[model samples]
Target: MPKGSGKVLAQNKKAGFDYFIEETIEAGLVLNGTEIKSIRQGKVQLKDSFILIRNGEAWISNMHINTYEQGNIFNHDPLRVRKLLLHKKQINQLRVDVKRDGYTIVPLKMYIKDGYAKLLIGLGKGKKNYDKRADLKKKEANREMARAVKAKNQF
Candidate 1:
């Protein structure tokens, strides 16, 4: 999901509907041992998560990575602010771009690639109320058109 080909652990479906995504970047997560294990087990949620660039560093906040069931005292926190690995230049660029009005960083999905946990983040502009309605209407029209085409082809 969200352009990732690997095993997708979690995804934020609302992110796409709420914002106009300008660009997406895949960044590494600084995860705990148990956290990665849980992620590999597909025990993660990105619905309420977001990305923020602060003090020249990127952080993913409110991302929930459930604890490994077999782990004991060394279990990682389910809701923790994890650091995102990005180049300094990319961070600077994000810092500059995020200052624009209506622009914010949102996490699209989380997946594992090459045995590492990767988070896909997007630079997005918040959509207006009217924009959301128009999008929904367009989607419905497209669906109707597809259905009509299918019926015609079947005749």
Candidate 2:
């Protein structure tokens, strides 16, 4: 139902590679007219973007939404601290979790749902080098097994 409500624009693939995602949260973003237009045009970047909770409020930084082509002087900054809309209870929960060491909030995806911009953020812990290697080895082994089964079935 959530997927049906919105069209995804961009995703941060690097987030998964660099961190072990522990939990996911859906939050709304506050955007201006031109900023929304720009996002709808697929002119957005999530690389190196992250979320922070400060003073009982949540903010997303380093996320770039390109200026709308048609808007002059009124277009929003490409990278700004955009406020994330979430219930007080949700915010409080996230605030508590984020205070834990080695945990962070990473932007996972940007999408338009019900005519509004939404941010998918994840609570993640940085993965060690060996952990990444182990994941890669597992994926490779799975791929190899799949290929062997497919080849045998085709014979």
Best by lDDT: 1
CA lDDT, candidate 1, residue 97: 89
Off by more than 4 A, model 2: 3-5, 149-155
Query: In candidate 2, which residue pairs get closer than 3 Å at backbone N, Cα or C atoms, i.e. clash?
Result: none
| Residue range with the least summed lDDT across 10 consecutive positions in model 1 | 1-10
lDDT of candidate 1? 0.90
Query: Which tens-of-lDDT digit does each residue in 48-101 have in candidate 2?
Result: 898988888999999999999999988898898899998998889988888899
Instruction: Tell me the lDDT of candidate 2.
Output: 0.89
> TM-scores of the models, in the given order?
0.92, 0.90
Backbone N/Cα/C clashes per model: 0, 0
The predictions' CA RMSDs to the true structure, in order, are 2.0, 1.9
